[model samples]
Target: MSENIIDTGKLVEEQSDYLLSFAMSKLQDLELAKDLVQDTFVSAITKLDSFENRSNIRTWLTSILNRKIIDHWRKAETRYTDPVSSFFDQEGKARHWLVEKKNSTSVETVVDQITREEATMELYNCIEKLPPKWRGVIASKYLEEKVSDDICKEMEITPSNLWVIIHRAKLLLRDCLGKAEFQ
Candidate 1:
């Protein structure tokens, strides 16, 4: 029984970097990754007795960290919800805060502004579902607005490969967004 027990301090020392890197890959936020790792340790230690020792300590810790990450994303999806009233007037006209006073802006522009925040959030959530390499590729191409040549050089992929990756990522995002709309 004693031999089966994990040494908390030693496990932390051995696995901290690996866990942190794993969290960083999934979350892309340094501070949040650190917080999740700490939370993982706390939860694991608190429930140490329940650990069956069937798997190694690192795998156990990783499972706990993954759960924490899922919970964080779930909470974030509902956080900072925009009030529908804020976008509409009492007469039911859409608010024009996002547009300039110039009349040249079209109705599509206003509608886009109204739905932009929600769509952006949904797109980000979909991006999170992508594989780590694809996530980085999508971020560089779209979010960072990197040129194709530069992205190819940076990611060490050919131009054709870059387009293929982008196509796949976009397809995944479209599927995710479609499903999110129903939910």
Candidate 2:
């Protein structure tokens, strides 16, 4: 039993980066992603007896991380917005404002002007400015690559609710990033 435990522990350590990256992709916050990864390992270790060899260890651990991400989102969404206030009421949805549509910009120009490290840092800074709720979903879904069903399950949200949150978050992120231009 002890030997089996050690093997599981080793496996977890070996796959920590993959798991962490997966969670970070979904959750976006490095600290929170790290916490979720650690928690997943702990949960897996405690439930080691359930390992029936039906699935790879990484898959099982990722499933756990997906759940954790959803839980994080649910808590964040509930905490940030009041149910009664209706700040994001469907009726009040913003109209599409493309007052001045422009052609696609060239990324090559920007890429050539900045070092990779600098560009990465700038993007990181922009991401850091995102609201917690928005950040969590982007991190988990985009960064972590967890499925929508898993995300919804973790956050205890309906698909519609998830869509609304994601939509609003993107708008906010766009506005926030726009502000960076002046600074």
Candidate 3:
């Protein structure tokens, strides 16, 4: 039993970096991702007796992490929600206090705002599904707005490898996002 415990610790430690990247891609919050991964390991250790060995340890831990992510999203959605009409008057014109305080600024239509938000959320979900290295390259290039040279340097890949990874990642994202709307 002690030997099994040692093996479990080694296996979980090996998978920690991948789990951290997975959480980070899902949450987009480094600290939150770290916390989630820590929580995942703790849960695994506590439930060690029930593991049954049917799946790899990583898959088991990922399922737990995903549940936590879903719970967090649910809590966040409820916490900040306001009535749809709260920011708009009867005419659907913007009447929010912050909008009124701005000078010479254009107000975005609510429909467009909601659509953009949905697309952004779907994009993040697709990104999270990508392989860790490919996701890192995509995030560095697009989210961080890094140049090719910089990305190549930071990722320790050759320029050609970087180009190949970017191209493949884009194709994967395109396929994923194209199917997202149907879901």
Q: Give the winner by TM-score.
A: 3
- Of 2 and 3, the candidate ahead on TM-score is 3
What lDDT does the true structure give each of the candidates? 0.79, 0.70, 0.78
lDDT of 2 by residue, 1-183 (tens): 564544755776667877776666556689989888889888888888787666766667767887888899899989897665553346775433333333445578655544543334335545556777667777889889989998888777889988998898778666755554311
Stretches off by above 4 angstroms in model 2 are 1-4, 87-183
What tens digits encode model 1's per-residue C-alpha lDDT throughout 45-71? 778877778676766887899899899
- Look at candidate 1 and give me any clashing residue pairs: none
RMSD value for candidate 2: 21.3
What TM-score, computed on C-alpha atoms, does each candidate reach?
0.43, 0.45, 0.46
Whole-model lDDT for model 1 versus the true structure? 0.79
RMSD of each: 10.8, 21.3, 8.2
Clashes of 2: 14
Candidate 3 local distance difference test against the native: 0.78
Query: Sorted by lDDT, highest first, which candidate order results?
Result: 1, 3, 2
Which model is ahead, 1 or 2, in terms of TM-score?
2
Error of 2 at 158 (Å): 54
